[model samples]
Target: MAMSRNLTLLFYVTLLLIVLTTNQAESLSSQLSQPQSQSGHSMYGATQGSLNPQACGPRCTMRCSATAYKKPCLFFCNKCCAKCLCVPPGTFGNKQLCPCYNNWKTKRGGPKCP
Candidate 1:
């Protein structure tokens, strides 16, 4: 009788573990399938005024570098100047350091300067 009780207990424990694992996997799958929000937009890295001609430019031909991690503006200043402008994630073009090409700049390995 004791052997039968031990077997039943083990069986119940195994079933509980399986159920827990299955539920965990389902939760993970659902989370992965859900869409992410970017700048209050429903697409990755998309924002309002992203396609505005005035913000981008009338005839801007500036292209982003292949290795640039952030989105490049369509009208960034060329490398010949000391001060340039950068387009922040959620807003339009904003003034920034010339050669750095980022909204924030760093000096001597310190924190970024806005």
Candidate 2:
């Protein structure tokens, strides 16, 4: 009888552990699936990010390297990357990889992502 009682207690403990584990996993996965907000960059304006933001600095630096207008190029490239979360390959063309970067324009209808 005592062994049976111990077994039942162990079973309840195991079930509780399983329930807690499942709930924690579900919570983590839901957080992962949810989009996170970016803060402290309103000066660049609001745009949707579709790629890993951690990679933006290197990608933007590469994109802006060849330009004589490094400051504005870096600024805009980082801005576009923050919004589109993508940067075209190489220091030149290949904007086709990111349509958001490719199609964004200036106030007078110039390419905004450059």
How much is 6 displaced in model 1, in angstroms?
A: 0.4
The sequence of per-residue lDDT tens digits that candidate 2 reaches over residues 34-114 is: 344475332121223445788788878888899999999999998989889877778878777677898999999999998
Best model per lDDT: 2
Q: RMSD to the native, candidate 2? A: 10.1
TM-score of each: 0.33, 0.56
Give the per-residue lDDT of model 1 (tens digit) for 30-114.
Answer: 6555444654432321222233334333212233332242223332322211132222332323323212434334466632412
Candidate 2: stretches off by over 4 Å: 1-50
**Residue 44 Cα positional deviation in candidate 2, in Å, after optimal superposition:** 23
Tell me the deviation in Å of residue 84 in model 2.
0.2
**Against the hidden true structure, what lDDT does model 2 obtain?**
0.77
Q: Which pairs clash inside model 1?
A: 82-98, 83-98, 84-98
